[model samples]
Target: MRRWPRIAAWCVAALVLAGAALGSATVYFGWYDVSATGPHTVPVYALLDVASTRSVKLRSADIDVPDLDSPDRIRRGDALYRAQCAQCHGGPGQAPEPYALGLNPAPPPLVTSARERPAAEVFWIIRHGIKMTGMPAWQYRMTDEQIWDVVGYMRVLPTLSPQQYRDGAPSGGPASSLASASTSPSSSATATPPGDMRVGDMRVGDAKAGRAALQQYLCVTCHAIPGVPGARHYVGPSLDGMADRSRIAGVVPNSPDYMQRWLMDPQGIKPGTAMPALGLREQDARDIAAFLQTLSNFE
Candidate 1:
């Protein structure tokens, strides 16, 4: 009987070693397909989704988003959108690039996406970015002001009316579009950016109204603050005090219009950017900017 116990332990150990060898073979032999095109098996996908969500939450705990929206902020945001984001994500009433229409999660329109997540989550996704899924991180290429402008614009994109897409005026991409849009030779605290509607080069509407509309859109997902609840992993940035940031997405001016442009289609500004275009309408974008402008880091 005593000998039987020792024999059983050896048998179990042998089985475990065999299983390890099998698992290794599966990987080394390319038996498991890693292609995104290959839909995940139900169990595998479920497990991965759970793991992804958990990992994002754990990894993004330390990120921060500056006060993002303001009269100046939203305008710049609007410009950023026009110059960099408009094509892929579109604004107010337009649609995203044909690709956005077909993407897996079907890029939620920011107008509504903000409501779905917190501001910090939005910001983290914009800054640190995502892996695989074509969502590139912007921490390297962009400036802080640029990122925040996008954040502020996202807050109010859900309320815009619509913009008519023009041919060949401007496009997204850091080098080409940003160099032209980054600095506005003429702008004031309340004045808007020119030519680009999303950039807020021109005034959109009431600031207080914009702020209210932004909160209604739910711009407080992933952002951290002195008091907002929940962890910062819902997929966007928080907006407790977004108006004070000097930059957006680490680039661009922090104006309402600019916020509009960046929020409408951030992928254009930073190619492969994970920040999904919320398909914001023009009026919605403006409102979001207005709302963001109200947030300030008053000491």
Candidate 2:
């Protein structure tokens, strides 16, 4: 045992020395490429990505998310994103400006990637900012509500075309212009009453499709949804009695409209939640809602 301990200590010491020597040599010789034009090797980029995601997840896990999806909130977020984020991250219509393109490890396009992350993690990254990267801490510069508003807008960013995005902006022309553009099912079809068999207000969509939607969107990775076999993960709260619950995410009332909104942008319903916006279509959210409602009496 004594010899084993000594051997382990020597091995650890050797590893530390080797790491130190390698780091010093890299610094002294400038062997690692620091140029923006020269991308990090695939393995290096993967490692950094994993580290950043893990760190964000661990640090932001405790933040209490509030509702992030509302008409006003999304509008506000859209304005802010256009004004500030579009310069670097770009959007549907806007390409990243030259300044952003020159940045080392260039900022990823938010419209494509933001929905995949938890709202809390995105909030933390926005508020605290990442070191070494160009992202600055916004907590000092912007209010919590504003950061959340930006997050809310990001939820819908993937869905918006450049024209829709520009129109939604206060300076981008009249909001009425959107009427000509919106081809969504809810907007295109004749308005149906609350309990219509095709698309009810409270109980809409096919349950079987909802289950499939849950699986397709990887909801089981976090929630232990009833009826979905093998959906027992504990990252978020269980969905066993989601239908009976009066409130969704402790805020929005449990109704089909609210649930659809929740599914579209959970952070908008409750900011800083582990639930990321999955960017599902209106009909898809309705399908998921129908399935979730059936879980009220689940065993």
Candidate 3:
């Protein structure tokens, strides 16, 4: 009986080792196709689905869902959804843009997703996007309140007809609403003065906005930016003490103008450099430079 038990243990260990070896070989030999054109195998798809679903469920369990039934909130969410999300995850009776079709794990039509997913799960997914999916983490661009508003809209999306979706939100899109809300008298009362900071002769570079822009532009994916939450990737040099650094990318003087220029067109300044020209807007470059200036020997 003891021998039988020992034999069973040996058999289990052998199976585990065999599985590991097969997996390693598959990876090392590149036998598995990763092309987005093809769909995943049934088992692989099932595994990923379970993993993602469970992850969302586990993480969203403790979320404090606010009352989301207000008409104004839903309208605001509708505008935001149209502006930000509709292109990829189409609205009711709306087709996603052609590009969304090419994505490997096709962006789910939110009409069905909204009906099936819990509010908390949807909110969490929007806030911290799914990895390897085209879905982006909106936390970098949108505030928590804005994300909640989207969630509120999603809760009511299943009930709206295609015509209703078109006629529901404001006409000028979310930009006007977002801009008005940000520049409202109440908000402007506490706004940072134009002269409070400057980057590259631009007085409009807000450090707070710059910080958010860094994440929005996915700079954290490559560089370990101070005060940004992301993987501590070493693909680019850390910007921990950028304020004190004497050179921009070890080429130009680390002045405001040079810094902004470097950010705007890194490849143009230093041809063949690993740094890419991110097509940053002038304001975005200035804001990023201002934010970088705040990273002073605090590593």
Candidate 4:
């Protein structure tokens, strides 16, 4: 019996040594293929896929997802996805760009896969992006709401056809199409023209420039603004109907000067608020104020 115990220990030590030798040899001889052309071995692929999925699930468990079914939210998400994601993930009707095919671990079609994921997981992946995959951390470029918007559209993407994608996709990047449309004379939804819409005693800044400044300040990440295409945020209050509101933060009067000051330094205006001071230049503040003033007729 004592001999048997010794023998078993030797067997375990031998197996460990053998594994170490094989691993070292593989690394030393460069036995693993790094080429993208060939698919991974079945075991390797299964391990990687499982690991990736589990990682996302574990990490995204705490994310609080919002209502992702709103038509307006989906539209905003569609524009953003077309501009930033279509090349890699493809749309309902759009094919993945040729460059995406060359990726070693091919990007899965989100139409089917995104449906399989929870919106919170999708939001986490979009916000933090996966490492070693070409996916980027859009936290720097896109806002929380914008990320959620993409998730929203992705949830419904499996149902869309190519023709539907073509018909419904917004014409350009959010920064361009929405800005131009908001300023176009015929783009107003209400009976009165947006150019003629007025806020009492408040000077409207240049609408076009205000739109540009909005992008520059990265306001789209937190506030969903009407006429701003993919500006689907939920972090802060929606600025869509700000023009008609009697108060700015529901505490102060909604006047041009108050808005400009608020824009210049939000924390100063409302202490302990979640809004950040984007450090808008005086003119930038004016331009944003002017653009926001037009929201009354935006619909």
lDDT agreement with native, every candidate: 0.56, 0.68, 0.70, 0.67
**Which residue segments of model 3 deviate by more than 4 Å?**
169-299
Compared with the true structure, the alpha-carbon lDDT of candidate 4 equals 0.67
Measured on C-alpha atoms, candidate 2 has an lDDT of: 0.68
Cα error of candidate 3 at position 238, Å: 51
Count of backbone collisions in candidate 1? 113
Candidate 2 lDDT by residue in tens digits, 114-210: 6678889889999999877688999998899999999988888878765555556664432232233233444222234244445333345787888
RMSD values, in order shown: 17.6, 14.6, 17.3, 22.2
Task: Estimate, for each residue in 184-274, the C-alpha lDDT of model 1 and write its tens digit.
Answer: 3321112342333554443556765553333333333234332322233444466667789987776778987788777665645543344
Identify the candidate with maximal lDDT: 3
- Which residue segments of model 2 deviate by more than 4 Å? 1-19, 172-299
**Per-residue alpha-carbon lDDT of model 3 for 148-242, expressed as tens digits?**
99999888887876445545646664323322433354332133334443435556677887876665454654576755653322345788889
* Candidate 1 global CA lDDT score: 0.56
At residue 190, candidate 2 shows an lDDT of 27
Q: What TM-score would each prediction reach against the true structure?
A: 0.44, 0.53, 0.56, 0.56
Instruction: Residues 150-218, candidate 4: write the lDDT tens digits.
Output: 888888877775445555755674323323433454422212322442445445478788876665454
Q: Give the 10-residue window scoring lowest on summed lDDT in candidate 1.
A: 181-190
